[model samples]
Target: MQRRARTYLTGVALAVMLSGGLTACTGSPEDEGGEDTKAGSSGAPDSSAPPGRYRTLPEPCGAVDLSTLKKLLPDAEGAPQGSSTPGKGTASGDEESPYEGQPIATYDTDRRAGCRWKSTNSLATRNLTVDFERVVSYDPAVSDDEQAQLLYDERAGQAEIPTESEPPADEEGGEGGDPADEGGKSGSGGSGEDGGSEAADSGTDGKGGGEGGGDPGGEGEKSDSGGGSDASEEPGGEPSPSSDADLSPRTLDDIGDNAYIDDQLDTGDSGVHRDITLVFRSANVIATVTYDQWLTDKRRTPDSAELQEKARSVAEELAADFDDN
Candidate 1:
């Protein structure tokens, strides 16, 4: 009986050891799963940051002041305000309405908006188009202002304007004659004077005086007249076209963060068309103003100074509106 009881006790101890080993093996997998879950949670990406600086855009048609619009499109002074609907016009056909402006086609109004005003009169035809773009930075590390500056630089590059406001060094050569040409003129003048004096000394004193005086006077007059005419006709004798200067984009100061003007003149069978584009960035918003004038007479072109003045005035008004908003 004692031997049987001892055997039963040994069997019970073996059962308890087996149960502990099974428990430890099963618990290891569960612990490992818990650790993996914690790691996954900690490795998740952060998505709580803000998305962009601007949440909304201003109304397209009402963005610019009415007075400014009238100044830009003089004929639109008495006309009604235009609709902001995309691809739809107040009139039945695509023809622009008398007083109402035209809405530019845009896929997204929240990100961009544009309006156009066109008027035809006996004196001239004028058209004004304005576009607004709201920039949003996706990079978490970049600020709105920095992103805006980058975008402005890109726009300026696209317009082919110099990054800075200064004119190029080559353009300065316009005012002064080339060094080589000046040197050649001086050499030729000296030779002519010397030849005239030599001829005078070889001839009779009285005849020499007359001949020398006549030769020098005639040569001096020809040279002076030729130089003056050439200088006036082609300053520096540079082949640079006047159109290049007119079309080249220029940077503007005292306007927004950065601003530039792009002027283009097109001559067509109908008449001369002048397009003046003024782009300025205020904070995160980019505003573009395009002023167009058409002259029926081919001989006459739109005044650039007047067009620029109108564009700048409109830009200032838009900037002020942005500030007010």
Candidate 2:
């Protein structure tokens, strides 16, 4: 009887082991990680945004064309230190040997890279710095472009550029040189100066300038007449009483998706110098061009028009290059 009991127990144990193996082969709901796993997930809709348009940044040191470099930095063609240039190097480091821009030091080249170039001449000493930043969104809900825009807005705010109050484009009244408005204003008195009024009137008198075809031509000449950007050799070339409105830091419409320019003047041991900076945003990347000139001659101030134009040109070139890529 004892032997029979031992055999029966062994058979029951074998049967139990076989039943467990069959259950394993059938698989559990959780084991498959299919429907069960999916159901267990948070089940929330994905609000994630698309990544930035640019995945990689260009090499900052090599991004600029040689011609542009030469134009901005006169000494780029290889000016020996103190080649009749007024002051010593404005930059902290030794002058760049051949004037190739010096790359800014950054741990992450993928996210940010910069190049700085300095040039000196008897007229004025100039420094140029170009920075490229690739924005990334930490929160899935925010996009790279949106994040970059926010950052740009912040930078612009810190610049202390006067708000759009001085701008005629605002609702209160800076119509941005409407030809009709120009006609009315000049009609009162601006028409007297044939050089200015005639040009403005002709520009406004229906020239295929889009809706405001004549507005640009007319206003540009008005500004020119007032010597706004081109402070020419006119007897009245000194900044007009209204020149503050023209020289004030203002937003630019023709550059990138959005852009602005800041101009500031400071007087110190180095005489009066002008600092012009252009900041623009393209997709998820932000490029900044900072060009400033220092003159030792306090008798003559640096011309805003020349520096502003050069800075804008560099910024525009950088923007165009970004678009191409």
Best by lDDT: 2
TM-score of each prediction? 0.54, 0.58
lDDT of 1 by residue, 1-325 (tens): 9999999999999999999999999999999999998888776534323454465676665556555565566555444444534222234566544334556666788877777666554556667777777767666655555566666665555445656533354543345668745543333221121223322322222111111012211211000010111111221112222332333457888678788787666554434556667878888777788776666555665655566667788888777777776
What local distance difference test score does each model get? 0.56, 0.59
Candidate 2 Cα RMSD after full superposition onto the native fold (Å): 15.6
Model 2, poorest ten-residue lDDT window? 206-215
lDDT measured at residue 244 in model 1 versus the true structure, 0 to 100: 25
> For model 2, how does the per-residue alpha-carbon lDDT over 1-325 read when each residue is reduced to its tens digit?
9999999999999999999988987777557778766665645335678899999888766666666666666644444432211112223355534345656666788887767666655555667777777888787888888877766665554454332322232432344567656543433221111223322322222121112011212211101211223233222223323434455577788888778787766554434556677778899897777776555455665567666777888888889988888
